[model samples]
Target: MRIPSLKLLQGFEAAARHGNFSRAADELCLSQSAISHQVQQLEQQLGQPLFRRVGRGVELTVAGEVLQQSVRRALDNLQGGLGRIAGYMDPGLVVLVCPAALAQGWLQPRLAELRRALPQLSLLLSTDESARFVDEIDVDIVIADRPLQQPDVMERRWLRDGWLMAAAPELAQRLAALPPERQPSEAGLLCLEDGFTDARAGELFRAHLAGFRRVGIYDDARLLLDAALRGEGLACLPKLLAAEALADGRLQAVAGYPAVDGAQYWLARIQGQPRAAIVAEVYAWLARQTEEA
Candidate 1:
């Protein structure tokens, strides 16, 4: 079947939504008779009556109601797509790519501070882990564990986390019952497979935790911390991620384990973007937050 004209469809859609041809005409800036004529044209093309005249107003027939739902949905989708395209072209928009765990544990809580610091900036947070440079993504900045080494990009160490072995209070108590030397052997370890920023740190972590029996392995810090909270095992996590839990008595540090220097978070951006100054401002604000962290 041939597709009906957009004008006819638009007229019918507006009329059906308002339940009055006159109001639809007013909204479309056309006369009521013009709206009636378009609706009649659409109905003739479809070989069905689209509306039933009720006194001065009109009501949609069963077929018209179905068409209205489809038309409204299509129009909404078109408008939404255009809005996203506009946002993509917006110069003030800053996109950030970072890990989901960090986004949830760190960045999300301090969003209000960021807003106050950069009132004119509009931020879009992406949890894509594979993007190496700002050009690789639609992002203005990248907050990642490893530094980007591209010539077109600049990176700086944003945060250096202090790590500690922690577990749920109940799990800590269970470990405490064992002798100092036997505790490491007896306790189950919740390990993060790729937690370190560099190979050297990963090697150090592996060497340090070699004595513990591995019970679980995770890629995400949040999941590792969650497992520890459930009394599943003792996990070595950044103090920044576990601070609130430790303070609330939900998790506690294991005795005899010193805080080790963990991964460094790096903030990267393209060297010569139009928003370079804005990126630097945000980078400085993040550094300030890290100092407080």
Candidate 2:
């Protein structure tokens, strides 16, 4: 009941993937005969033929196909572990992952603050949220809403979406002056569109505004924000995102319109080591933002 050597498994996996011993040998920096020898040793140990000759190349047998699946997964996991080690070894590096829309809407607006907070830190800001939070090995912080059950990962309340109807200063006043009946068709709405039906704001406003004109329907809130800034129309936007503009008098929340509280996003971090100083700074900034909420 002994396991085959790693070299044997690597050889078998590479050969099966390439369907050619010479190609597999080239990839592993070994000769064709050496790769063949390793595969032979593995087959003998497992008491089954792993590959069958097909013309100038080879193909996996039924047992080999099953083993290939496991071997590929094992190698991928090992690679991810090693990559995480590399990230830890680099003292200044902090890998941050967040949703694209959030990055555009939130981080882009706070670039100055981010630079001031970590002048010496190397920040890798990734906006690809398609991958599952736990499977991301090298990432230091994740801004996500998905709940993770793992004990080793720490989660904090990050942001709760608060949707409000808003527009540029001039437009806000105009919308306010309109009678309630005519506001729906005349306000000129700039809508936010996302995978969610509401885009966090649309559904709440929809019931009241039946025939409103769409100035534009944008996938990114940032875009809709820009249109609102240009005095395009009233938009359903995250109040937190518009806070700075609202304070500066660039945008104003339309009064007496229905506003809805939306979903909350969580800040997730790995609890164990390979920690960077920059990671703490980034987490602290997010913590402060939550505190502000």
Candidate 3:
């Protein structure tokens, strides 16, 4: 059998999800009768009753449920494919992907310099750490813990980074008054959720910060950094992320919890990609920041 039109499928899915034809029509900016007409077309084409009418709304039949799942998945995949195509069509665009914490600490401060360096190129920033492969068609450059194996990409060690334990100045001072053994327990701890940080936070805490109580576990390093700034508790995070705050004296390094060494990152970029000269200049600027830091 031939497939039905996308318009009909869209109407059916929205109506099924909302369980109210009027609400679905409102969401789609169509009249209630238009949605009902689309549903009728779909039901007639399939020769089945997709929904059962109730007092003021509707409920999906088994067939409707099955179709809804498949339609939702197909539409989502279609949207993703379209987005990728759009990226390819933009010639002046340069996509850069890095960890959120790295972006917050390193890129956020240096955006003006980057814009000055690449005045003609449109820089697209993505904070998804999983997009760290230069070979990914959507990503042109990445700051990653390890280098991509593809020969078409070139990589350099940006910096050797590690976890740094710090707290607000007042909190650090208060903790300093306590004995070394009691400092961690007295101050408590704030950190990223398990597997979020580059190092294994729980294991590191057990090995170094025994008897410490966790005050908060955040999914984002930025949030954890904010918590530390608010004097919520001592925060353990990537050194590169906390370095700026520490240098400026907004955050003070807590003694006895020296940095750990497994958080190094490498900068990788695809060779001869779109706008090579501009990308090269931007990449060089980024590398220079690591040296200055």
Q: What shift in Å separates residue 59 of candidate 3 from its native position after superposition?
A: 32
Worst 10 residues of 2 by lDDT: 130-139
**What is the C-alpha RMSD, rounded to one decimal, of candidate 1?**
4.7
CA lDDT scores, all candidates in order: 0.79, 0.79, 0.82
Ranking by lDDT: 3, 1, 2
Regions more than 4 Å wrong, model 1: 1-8, 40-66, 79-93, 109-116, 119-122, 130-137, 147-152, 160-163, 169-180, 193-211, 243-251, 255-264, 276-278, 287-293
After TM-score superposition, the amount by which residue 199's alpha carbon in candidate 3 deviates from its true location, in angstroms, is 6.4
lDDT of 2 by residue, 44-67 (tens): 899999999999999999999999
On TM-score, the stronger of 1 and 2 is 1
Q: Write the per-residue lDDT of candidate 1 for residues 1-293, one digit (tens) a residue.
A: 89887788888889998999999999999999999899988888999998998998899899988999999998899889999889876655778888787786667767888888888788888888886467734667888888878778877888776677888998798777876457777678887776544444465456766677878988877888899899888887777677668877999988766556766889888775536466678767876765775
Better of 2 and 3 by TM-score: 3
CA displacement after TM-score superposition, residue 144 of candidate 1 (Å): 2.0
- Per-candidate clash tally: 0, 0, 0
Q: Which ten residues in a row have the lowest lDDT in candidate 1?
A: 195-204
RMSD of each: 4.7, 7.4, 8.0
The regions of model 2 sitting more than 4 angstroms off are 1-90, 132-137, 199-203
Question: Which scores greater on lDDT, model 2 or model 3?
Answer: 3
lDDT of 1: 0.79
